[model samples]
Target: MTTTDVHVFFLLLCLFSPKVAAHGRIPTTLDGPFSPRTRRFDPSLRLGSDDVPMDDPKLAKKVGFNFPEQIALAISFSHTSMWVSWVTGDAQIGKNVMPLDPSTVGSEVWYGEESGKYSFVQNGTAMVYNQLYPFEGLLNYTSGIIHHVRLDGLKPGTRYYYKCGDSSLKAMSKEHTFETFPTSPDHFLRKIAVVGDLGLTLNSTSTIDHLSKNDPSLILMVGDLSYANQYLTTGGKGVPCYGCAFPDAPIRETYQPRWDGWGRFMEPLTSKIPMMVIEGNHEIEPQARGINFSSYLTRFAVPSLESHSESNFYYSFNAGGIHFIMLGAYIDYNQTGAQYAWLKKDLLKVDRELPPGLWQLGILLGDGGNIEQIDIEHADDPGKCPSKNPSIPEFGGICHLNFSSGPAKGKFCWDQQPEWSAFRESSFGHGILEVINSTYALWTWHRNQDAYKESSKGDQIYIVRQPEICLANIAKVSSKDQ
Candidate 1:
């Protein structure tokens, strides 16, 4: 065949390939800046699950006073150190409630490499917080003394057994074990699980069960944990969405017991695996005197100080070769704000050969099978595009603005699918990130319905980094030099 004819045939074959558009084929960022696409919520699958009852055995406070009930672990500054936190004493909820003295309980943890044999005992700090609604008829809630003890000088990749509580009061927990991340050249931070908007629902339980079965070394709860704000101050059934009932109330009411229940429900997993968290909108349970984020700030732990971000709202942590920047959407994300400054410094420190998302060159994983069900709104849908100023930021100033340059220039919602968003699906799913090497990482999305179906994945992609290209670009001179 002639040279021209041969070239024409080759181009045609490439364009008509069947496998290229198939769902089974995994994609890479190298093939994009892709056109935006949105997948509508499935009609067959459930939109959401009912909140788990307080009477459920898993969420009940099983431990007695002075004993640790909601035991949890968090990664500190480095692999050599880890934080263990738990609660002691029974909480009180009534018209005239008194908070327990934190000093009443001696915070301590006994741990070692061997099971049932503790070689080290560490002392920690203890404190308590209260959620009070000044208005009448709204019962006040006080939390049990929360203890946080740090275990330094730990061996990397070694499994250590621990029990935390007030030993002086003869209250100590049963033995539990966890392994530290690998310290050296192996770069083995195995499956990192990511979940968002996880409320205390049967579907949330299913998500947790499936995630546990996957055996992830770490978990990142992006936000909206427990859904405690969905309840009334009286501990009665609340409206599904936030602030739907009693819109003009003085302050948003929350049943603080839901936090306790959530802590208990998560203890089984958090006790073994370090679950790092960032605050979400639901965590902003506004009370009198402008006190918000009380439960979220008090209950869980993050590598804020350790990572040098210092603020719990936004921070960075390294797991093997991957560096994660957990940004707080509820807080100040403005360019002039503290979070933005910290983020800029962090980006400068990151190997530029890395991916985007600040210019937001990152994946948006919102498919965590949540109780509120799957998201259905799409910017490109006929009437689904959201309006400007739809909602105010929970903690910081509302900074969402119109596009300066794009098809939707001067508009908040795009008229059509924007090119940046490669694809989106409204479903309940959790993502597992498997870092294979310094340059390649595989991300898989597991749907709620696909549990127990091995090799079944809703979305799979390989994130490839171009270090050489980034290095060359960094070394290149600016246009001013020309």
Candidate 2:
């Protein structure tokens, strides 16, 4: 048979597979009230890995002072624009430290399709952040001048070359290149990587290397961008257990420099592809006077305002035909709270029918506290509830609360899987959503333990959109209307 015919045959086979079901943990349509399944974690994968040391070459500052370091990219509200960010200057760590004057170094980006030929220029703003510990023996920390510039009026599915820093100061980044996402919703983005709780560890390097080979157009870091708080001081030896070893400490010790190290390590990939991040518990580095989430709030820029959400903790963005909503589990999520109100409005605004064949994917991370917790309403079997609460308080405030209504109402843990939860697993894995058409999309989750070539998928499903049903709901009049 010809290549086209073979492709058609394979497509038909996938569509007809009996093992494939519609919606829930597996990809499915709104037609879900499906039974839930939980796969036990393999004993071999339970051991925690060590973080990459500060002195590692990959984590070192490759560029000189005043030159761009930790270069990265993030998606704007649309594919036509993208945000590029980086740091320039030396961070200070001592009892008495001064922050770099952001104005001292100008922030600029020069780019075009050709090398050494600057066709476009964009200027942006810069600032520095500090982690202060007033108590003696605990070192205070300050970051380098961080810059963020947005590139606009660009065509999608096209590659662009660029460099950043103060050109007049002889501080310019090495030439780097990145490709934009496809403009057409019908076109498929080959691979999109998703990962969470990815500390700077040897295993993290392995994960990054494997994900790099996949050539994902975008990356969704569900949370825990950098486990800097796991350490007591900048560049100090990170203890295996923080709460166990440092019980009497005023606050959990954090190695702020690790954030820079992580940035340097991820620059190679992030410089080219857009990465969207959500706040994880590890990001909530607390300080004096009841302060919290300082590191997370200052380091990354998310589309909270652009997406119409007021807080960075939660936001939504579109990739091809998929609409992804990243929720904040650490913030107030009660039905009467601001986040809940915002979410309701956001959900009401979605015209899923507009993006023909598009599917909706909601990813939840950091379920320790009262704001967001695992839904246990519909487990396939009893006595399988997670015994250990992995909710580490140092990461952030407790937000997980008991359900007021539903089958699992008034209970801290659900007896079975919740109706709203299609598939629930407590493993660290990333998912990829491939939009095949306006009506059908393929969803797959890859567990970290699975070999790169083996394709040992944790879950796979085809998401089907029913515009007819959605439109009917939109047309219905509520009791308030009467």
Candidate 3:
């Protein structure tokens, strides 16, 4: 869609640890519903930035056919097991592109706690995929061998050095290291950064660099990973508005090579820290015969079957005592859908649920008359509260409902700001959630423009949970497998 047709916003929500680092006390959620507070958008921080070129050094391929690149990690249900993925061989793009034989390359990983020492070895599967555009004049693309290996029976909160590639070809990747999440339920993972709508651009580089400086143990990517779909079937310079740029093209054309470039661009950070990702609309690269999600599905691995969700679109995983449910926004989230059904069961089984990035953080509220305008309206703003047909649904159900017991009971709109809205802002920013314990979590919102200007926060507060009040609602289920 054109830029005007598609007004998307990024919401960077970071889930952090309380004991990690803090300098002040904060308020809790028990202080009653907060009044609506708004921070106007800062004119200084440009909402848009230039995309990095495909040939940029960071996105350039650094390895040959036999060697592995894009080394990354994912949690396999628990810390006891992990999944490692990488790519080999050169991706081909042209009118006629042949797919690579994944079996030709052996997928293997060697790891140990100590450097230069070997204590464990694992062999995994590999495969290649293609994104074909059969329409005349459009280009077709084929991917390199993508590999995923699962390493199980490991200790948590421990560091492990490893290498992945075709061991037989002597083209294994150089040794890289990653640490497991904290093992104890009481212990928590510190410094998690969240981001979204991360196209391979100068802005994306800045965001990544900023996140790296924060030294996050894990990353929660909210979606719209790489905007490769923004380009045309015949690769050329990208435009900010896709629909306007290629008004005549058949379906949205994506430069598949951009995916490879993005993989390389993110390798450094991903290879070191475990990143959990859910799909965004951009991942749905529709191709021949209604096929889709080829790149997203084949490139990364998530704990779907492990979490018993059985679908990569949505799943739940635990990090110590905190359980994270990565929901695919592109998926059907209605009450009747399978995703909703799975979510119902998952939430019921939460032994302990503590709630929680910055990246992919897009606009939270855009101008009215579109899906992006669906926002948490301030009840006090006179004439601003929509009456009839107030809400609109995008890829999901219409969930607008009246509060049955709150101050706005029996009314679709409140006369004033809602107590639950402690604060709001129209600026581009990222938020960090620090869970102190089962009772309190600190949340701080950082504006993009003020990132380096003395650590000024646009919004900061503590979310205190009331166990006594909601204890009866807490459900218990078997955690034998989790």
Candidate 1 global lDDT: 0.73
Q: Clashing pairs in model 1? A: 356-361, 356-362, 357-360, 357-361, 357-362, 367-429
For candidate 2, the C-alpha RMSD (Å) to the true structure equals 8.2
- lDDT of model number 3: 0.69
> Which wins on TM-score, candidate 1 or candidate 2?
1
Worst 10 residues of 3 by lDDT: 365-374
**Candidate 3 residue lDDT tens string, 66-172:** 89988889878776888899999999988999999988999999999999886999999999999999998899999999999999888888889999987779998
- Lowest summed-lDDT stretch of 10 residues in model 1? 4-13
Q: Per-residue alpha-carbon lDDT of model 1 for 1-482, expressed as tens digits? A: 00000000000000010111223457876878877666665677764667888999998888888889899998776678888999999888888889999999998989998999999999989988999988877889999999999898999889999999888789999999999987554555778887777778877888888888889999888777888877777777745554556666566678999989989999999999998887877788888788898988888767788767857888876654456677876666666688877765676656354433121224465455445565566655688666665445345566678889879889877777666667766666677876655555677888776655768777777776575675456446222223
What C-alpha lDDT, on a 0 to 100 scale, does residue 320 get in candidate 1? 48
Q: Whose lDDT is higher: candidate 2's or candidate 3's?
A: 3
- TM-score order, best first, reads 1, 3, 2
- Over the stretch 1-482, how does candidate 2's per-residue lDDT look in tens digits? 00000000001001111222234454365556676545545566643456677889999998788999999898876667778899999998888998889999998999998888779999988988888888867888999988988888877778899999998998898898888777564465556676666677766776687677777888877777777887887456665456766776777878799899999999999998889887766677887766778777777767777779889888776554345667777788776688877765665556433423223345343211111112222322475544445436764355556668888788666776556666665444456656565566676766556777645776777767675774465456322233
lDDT score of residue 461 within candidate 3: 66
In model 3, which regions exceed 4 Å deviation? Answer: 1-22, 352-421, 426-429, 451-454, 468-482
Candidate 1 clashes: the total is: 6
